[model samples]
Target: MHDRPAPTPTPRSALPVQARLIVAVGIASALHVGKLPPALPLLAQELGLTLVQGGFLLSMIQFAGMTLGALLGQLADRLGPRRVMMVGLVLLAAGSALGAVAPGAAALLGTRGLEGVGFLMTVLPAPALLRRTVTEPGPLNRALGWWGAYMPIGAATGLLVTPLAYATIGWRLTWAVLAVLAALCAAGVRVYVAPDGPRARDAQAWAALRHGLHTTLSAPGPWLVASAFLMYSGQWLAVVGFLPTLYTEAGWSPARVGWASALVAGVNLTGNIAAGRLLARGVAPRSLLWTGYGAMALGAVGTFTAGAGLAYASALVFSAVGGLIPGTLFALAVRLAPGPQTVSTTVGWVQQWSSLGQFVGPPLVAALAARVGGWQWTWTVNVACCAVGALLAAALHARLAQQVRAPRPGQEGA
Candidate 1:
């Protein structure tokens, strides 16, 4: 099996100022209005979709992200992260614009799916860019941390801004605004992100991909990590999925759900930043994964029983943790790749699995809720799922540790 090449560790002075700036903008562009789930139903209705259809609309974005991310990463490894990101940003603009003007439901979903592809293009290479541009650990982690916050921030911002857009110009206009944001992000990348070192170009991307996929598939970590995601993402979305309904259950107005979701998303943004900081402080990747999964489970349990204010508070706590897991886990996934060359491909596989999870999460919770009674039963199922996810995390972490600690043939005597 191939092993990930140890990154040529750089000192702090070597951190690329421009690269940091590019990724920061990349973050802003990728998630802008993307994370606002409240707008999903409205977008669906406008496109004449049923609930199941709307769900697929959302699911396909992730589905696209999963497949596209690895493809984009491979392209990044071959052509360059800079070229890939710029192209992605351009697509982001075009996709958003098209989605805004889409005449029918399928057209809108296709455009959004393209946008998801663009999102992956911009995001999947971010860490690769960081590894390439940054040498020092602290600033690298900080940059990655900031990168993580961008999604939740964008999502929360979308939630905050979309309401006004909906009230004023409508969802179409909101998409237009997103297009503008995407265009701006494209411009930033064009001006800022520098080219990779010549060696990165020499990389055998296809071979790396084939090798990475094979190795990652053979490993237990990927399965464990993927399984953990199934539960964590499932429970997390389940909790979020029923929120508006839950709010209504408590006799709250429609506006209450919006505010609650926004607040939860905002707090969730903090978790991304926290993930970077926590990793910088030197926690093992497995530990962070477990913490994230645990938090998701805990939040499900806590809010499952709470009402009104208490429910929102529980929501906030759980979301923050949920936000942290993606980047942290991505980081770990890369580390687990059989070879540095294959990291992107391996990570893509994980993404494909997560996309599968996104599909499973909401319905499973809904089914459980239907079968049993009340939010408590719903949460009980979610909690159980997440707890299993925790176990998966533990197992993955253990397996990954073995990969890191075991010496390669050449280094055995060292």
Candidate 2:
């Protein structure tokens, strides 16, 4: 018998539509994370949560990512990105539905942990999926850029919608609505996206997974990327996560706070898109990283120390510039993966560190605020994180340069 022909690649025309569907799924998963900030004040009233507890609540959804991101990545590589993501969406729906009925803080926290796992499952495989789907270099960069923006887009949408929903239907119903959205998104993914390739035998699967994990862990690229994300994500989440609470404390109305915070989060997508364009135009990733971190530090200072008008302006600037980091990191994760088979694994490792930063940053900032009795010292934490990020960027630059200088297998001494 003749050997079977290779499967045809996704047609260029269909690529954009499928990519959009994948991004839509990601945005839906992120809604669970973003929905909480707007509802936090109400939760405090009903749940009797303290500031520190609220901080934990904000970070709780990352608990699974902090622990299981890499393992799930390997699982994605072994099973299929599409399958993994669909399962994730179902779990997200379940978690949100459960959270809607949670009677107290502890029960809500448990549901948040479930949501975390779903979020990780949905998002961790996405960059790799995009890589497989969008073949052209320029469009691939742009798609990854949009993928990078999914969180901000979803979170901003959540911020804008949640307060209105809370006013009309209340937070519980808002959660239920998002759960439905997740289910819908999963159905879209199933219908639109391509299925995974055939699975390898068990022995081959185990061997490939082992190799992917080792390759991802041993490489400096993933570690550098993960470390930079750690520095960026912690401060970014801490500041943005508390914005609703901060505004409420300052006596702003819920509607006003929702709009303002949404604007801050929305501008982040602009930077994310810009980073992809810049990279495609040959801009250095390290340069973008440094600019993002520096701007974040300056914005943090203004946000904390300046008067009201400048403080709000600083927040917008902070979020917009800081957006460059994730877009660049996503591109780097794909470019720097040790092998084609290891892309999701590498992203998983990077995500775990990013989750850890988010997990720790909020509580640390909240503790500081409680100790100092004000938000003035908030700039200190952000600035320190940015400073560390700048140093990591320099190291990453050196690594990239080394890669450029190294010879390909057959090109040695040519």
Candidate 3:
């Protein structure tokens, strides 16, 4: 007797039409958020922020983004990414305004947190929404590639923009200007994003939360990927957070650090696209993860050394590695669950740890940097973290390989 057939999984290529729309949103928001970090160190000086306080201030947007990102992401499935993103843009604008006019650190922190909330609303649903939009495999791979590109663009460009703003007006004005850009992002969302109505109106928040929790905790691959995100994200964010400060301490101009940080971030764009091309060709996810983490390790070492030329070379290396991790990691996160029932839930769970890493890393690094009284130890810490990340990636790859189907024998064409 013939055996019963297994349920065929949705081909990665057969994603829906909405993916392009979501990718556009990703690019816009990524650029907006990317412009932020570069301005952070500048904001620190202008606002007279202490190291710890600055880290908090820096983390403020991220924390809100993390916390609200998950919440809104769940809502995105119910309320629609278009609507939620619109609301987030409003919040982003409001928060940016608050920070722009901030007279003290307290006010700045408050506003940054608000911006985080806005960012959360706008960016969280991107993966899910995109997944729903595209249909063809080539487009699906390209769309994911775009989604992956957003991070480094957001992170690196934010830093690169700082000095130009600082030299001309100041950090406060920089905030104000970006606030306007955030508002424009809202408009972009409304214009470009189509309302899909509600997805699963019956799905309650708690139900979704429960779903995400169960799927994530139950799956070793998801948890391992989360751990990878935590280690790499924390290390990279903390390292980048300290870059400008490190430069000044190293007796280089703040301008040099800003430029170098930009290079580090820019390198990530290439890494992400490279990962996408590799992923499309049926490369193992773990290979991408390892290469990304390895790049970070090299960059971390580069960040630690003295001398301008060495710093640039190492930073470029670091950024290259950093770029590759997110696309591969996130792609893995989307598939970490066993079935479609848990996709969003598992993705949200992975995000939870991503946020956790982002939330904690900067402050911990700042505290350590304060104790060490320089950025050397900060860079050292990052190198170690990246090394750990590489190891973790290896372990996850091994485990996931067991669960995921290998490329079929004689299978041709991705």
Best model per lDDT: 2
Q: Looking at model 1, which ten-residue stretch has the lowest summed lDDT?
A: 1-10
Worst lDDT 10-window in candidate 3: 1-10
The predicted structure with the larger lDDT, 1 or 3, is 3
Please give, for residues 287-398, the per-residue lDDT of candidate 1 as tens digits: 7777777777677777877755676777888889777776576556545555555555555666566666665666666556656665577667766776676777777767
lDDT of 3 by residue, 154-219 (tens): 667777876777778976787778778778877866765555553453657567655655544676
- TM-score quality measure for candidate 3: 0.84
Give the clash total for candidate 2. Answer: 0
Weakest 10 consecutive residues of candidate 2 by summed lDDT: 1-10
Question: Candidate 2 has which clashing residue pairs, if any?
Answer: none
lDDT of 1 at 96: 85
Better of 2 and 3 by lDDT: 2
| Residue 130 of model 2, lDDT score | 86
Deviation from native of the Cα of residue 352 in model 2, angstroms: 0.4
